[model samples]
Target: MEESTNIDQCTMEQKEPRKVTKRKFRYIGDFQVSDLECPKKRRLYWNPTQKFMSSSRRKYVTLKTKIHRLKNRINYLSTLLTELTECDRKFPVPRSIDFNKQFVTVELIQGQFVPDLMNLIIRFADSSK
Candidate 1:
């Protein structure tokens, strides 16, 4: 009975092929697109990384250019401010004026000094006439 039981177990083991579980392989170093052969799979893996790198580089250059332009603008504005300050200091505006005029004729005084209100009244009367 024991011999027959051993024979039965051996036959059963042979009939059921050993269910071998394969361990999925992992990559060690980075593999390039061409290494991954099939075109679609290669594109899926590589394109996004390349695209991101390109866009980021472009953005970096643009930012650098803008910074340079802003620096130049600041320098120009500073120069303009200095010039304006110098002008203000050099020439201040004059506000009030006082004046007197004299005239002489060959035998008499050509003009007379008249009071301010009288001059205005005379001018008004002449205009009304």
Candidate 2:
């Protein structure tokens, strides 16, 4: 009976072969590197373990962030400009405020102000006319 069981097991093993399943790697986009001479090196290069952002995707994200930041800055500046205009109206300047010609005079005022900010303000004021 043991001999018969052993023979049965041998036959069963011969009848069915174990199926070896290869790992299916998913690559980003249609581009794939399969020209490598070594299979092991190819597998390592195509390994999904390492996450990488494509250059176009990185640029898109950077542009999106910049646009959002600029939009917020524009909104803030708009509100600030309106408030400043209202305040200026309420408290009239003793002297005529001329943005076009008074840049030199404004720069002479004793206060901590960025030159770039002053330039931008002057440009904005000039463009509004």
The Cα local distance difference test for each model comes to: 0.67, 0.70
Q: Give me the runs in candidate 1 sitting further than 4 Å from their true place.
A: 1-43, 88-129
Give the C-alpha lDDT of model 1.
0.67
Tens-digit lDDT string for candidate 1 (29-129): 34564657977656565665676678899999999999999999999988876676689466454435543322323223433434554788999999998
- Please, what's the RMSD in Å of model 2? 18.1
Clashes of each: 0, 0
Relative to the unseen true structure, what is the Cα RMSD of model 1? 24.6
TM-score for all predictions?
0.35, 0.31
What are the per-residue Cα lDDT tens digits for candidate 2 across 32-125?
5553567775655565434444656788999999999999999998887667668946744246678855775566574534676689999999
Residue 112's lDDT within candidate 1 is 49
Highest TM-score scorer: 1
